[model samples]
Target: MRITSKVLITLLIVVAITACFSLITHLSNESQPVGDEIPARILISQTPLSTPLFVAKKLGLFKLHGIDITLIPCNGGVECMSMMTHGKAQYATISESVAMFNSFRDTDFSIISTFVTSDDDLKLLALPRRGFTSIRDLKGKSIGVIKSSASEFYLDSLLLASGMKPTDIERVYLKPDKLIQMMKIGKVDAISSWEPWGYRAQATMDVVNLGFQGMYTLSFNLATMNRKDETSHERSKRILAALQQAITWIQDHPEKAKAIVSDTLNIENNQLDWMWRDYVFRLSMTNVLLANLQLQARWALEHNLVEGKQPDLRSILDRSALQAMQDEVVGQ
Candidate 1:
């Protein structure tokens, strides 16, 4: 039968619409954004700080599950965060303390999951001029810090323990790496920083160590996002699961774990090992940590860090995904 021009046009239009629908369905079904198929680009700091996540990616854990992670070199956590905030990247690793402090202050971000934290990681180093051995000696002395960041809060906690307020001592804001040089030149009386800086000072300058661990009650390096809801939650779960696997491997095969980290960070095996021991990963969150976070929120509220209203503590944390992953990990 000969088809009319009108029918031919209508049939063509129907075919085009059907084809478009089919293509969209196929793409949606096949494009797994969670697991390893994530399209979100990730940026990490240049330092060895993000070694575990790097190890997970290098080991094919991310790819095996379909995660497409783009690792960009950044100067530090704050820099990585800037990349995320500016839309240069989707996610970045940062200390939970930083996120909490910022969130308290109504900063624009949400916590995805936690990374590594330990009691042995932070140290307070004294300059040669001050000859400070205890937190008390830090009184009236200028201490270098990564101000308004997690590092600052860690130092504040240390000071508070010593009966000193933030106003009691002058804090000089500097990058972690520059503190040592500043100390050598008498630019600052002391420095509070994490390893490499902590270890570097001990090895190079014999910087007196005051009794303080970078350890906080709830230390977490979270995967952050500006978006919230099911999709982000699912992605966060996959990332946390991958992190948990990496942590488990680190615990079971300490030497091999060191090698993985060393390779990822491009650090010497010995240095990696030293750094490895300093980190503790329990892969568990607790009420105590929640309480601490609430305390942090309260502090921010009291100090006007957050907006006029405070956020719900329970709503801020989505630990259900982590719990499910933990169950699976434990089962295996």
Candidate 2:
């Protein structure tokens, strides 16, 4: 009887210990952060506009927010958008102009958020020795621009603003680096492109800035495939959150942020200093962005850049991620 009682007591104690261990393990697993099991690839351009992404990756903010990000480098937003469209990356950083041009043909992706905005990012650089000292000199001259890009749009806008038409110049379509090279070799009289290409052109060759600042406001945005599933929605939120944190850190530490951007882009610190003040870094979907898209769409249609009737621009925006975080998503 004594042995039986002792065995029964020992069994009960063992069962209690095992139960406690199981409960603790279950709670521990439940308390762990979710969403790090899968790695996410984001296509980013080698520009200061993508500073937040660089900062976020460098500081491990993505991991802090439960996401693993692999940054894929691209030449420009157009390339990044293309890579994202082909399923090469889960996300891409693009300018609003890229989104606008694509919205005419496809609704396969959505602009998740606009992380940065700058009016002076796109510049019209001219070769002074080629008798191109002013914006007006671009007339009848070969101008290098990236077709279907903010570079093209800004060039057109600059020309229009300067009382010249798009047809006034010979449009030399080329990649950003090629444009810079063409400018260096005097192959093109002027090149309208975004920084750091613009900065690179000035740094490498004797180029003059035509000084058409504030002609266009370029929004650097995040884009993902148009997925409305729960998984996609959650993933978007995680990315935005990580970016928001990065933006905050950037605002708090401007010098450090600039250093990070300079290092990431392999550009000189002076280049960043020249354009740092032009950029407004934050996470928002504002009325201004919507209106800019509408304006760009109108420009595209007027210029025959897109043939069909303007697709509903609002449909291309996925604000659920921004809204989920209680962030300000103004103007739909």
Candidate 3:
């Protein structure tokens, strides 16, 4: 009886200790703040326009906001949006024009915020050898552009501003890299593209800037699918918070931010300096974005770029995440 009692007492004590240990562990876990465990894959184009995103990743701001981000680099926003659409990524850093173009077909994604804007990002570069020294020189000339992209829109806008129409020029639809190569070989007289392609073309070839400016403002925006779930909304808010931090950091530390961009993009300091002047990095949903979308939609309709009625431009914006951050969603 004595031995049995001793054994029972040992078993009881073991059970009590195990229970106490488990309880302690459970309580400890409950007390600890959640770390950076929220995984997000953001498709980013390799361009200076994505400076804030580059800053966020370089400075680990995303993790600080409880987001584990994997930035997948692509050639441009067009490809980034395509990858996001195919579910290869959960988010994309795309130009608003790309979103506008896609809105005509499927309003599957919603623009979360416009993180950066620039009036001079897009330019008309002409090969002087091709007798293309001005915007008027583009008439009846072969111009390389990424069809259905901001490149095309910029080209058309420049043409309209020059009192010309799209029908007057031969648009050689090509990817950005191909456009550069085609221009070098004299296949295209001019290329309507955004930086750093324009910067790149100038570096590699003798090209003349057509001096087109202020025809359109390009905005780099964060876009994701229209997910209405609370969890998704929370995740988006976290992302916006991180990006907002990055934007603040960039503004406060311009030189450091420029260095980060220069190193990450492998762009020369002079090149960075050249393009950095035009970038206005911030988080906002202003009348500027709205007006641009409406104009693009009308242009798309007029040009038969997309079939059917115009997409309600306002519907494609999901400002819940921005609103959560008290972001500057102006004129909405």
Candidate 2 yields a Cα-based lDDT of: 0.87
- Give candidate 3 regions above 4 Å deviation: 1-36, 327-332
Worst 10-residue lDDT window, candidate 2 = 323-332
lDDT-based ranking: 2, 3, 1
lDDT of 2 by residue, 1-332 (tens): 25698899999999999999999998775345555545789999988999999999998878877887789999999999998999999899999999999998898899989999998998888878878778887778898999999998888888888889888999999988798888787788888898888878878878888957788889999999887677788778888878887898999999999999888878888999989999999888888888989999999999998889998889888888988865432421
Q: Give all TM-scores, in the order shown.
A: 0.77, 0.87, 0.87
lDDT of 3 by residue, 252-292 (tens): 99999989999999998888888888899889888878889
Once superposed on the true structure, which residue ranges of model 2 sit more than 4 Å away at CA? 1-36, 327-332
Q: Scored by CA lDDT, what does every candidate get?
A: 0.68, 0.87, 0.86
The segments of candidate 1 whose C-alpha lies over 4 angstroms from its true place after superposition are 1-36, 46-49, 105-108, 128-130, 214-218, 226-231, 300-309, 323-332
Q: Using alpha carbons, what is the TM-score of model 2?
A: 0.87
Model 1 Cα lDDT, one tens digit per residue, 1-332? 99999999999999999999999988775333443366557777755567667777767656644556677877667667767877888777766556665564445565555566667667777854456668887778898888556667678778778888878888899986688899888888888777667767777766677755544643556556557576666666677777776777667877887776666666677666666666766565567556767777776666454576666655556566677677765774
Give residue 270's error in model 3 in angstroms.
Answer: 0.8
How many clashing pairs in candidate 1?
Answer: 9
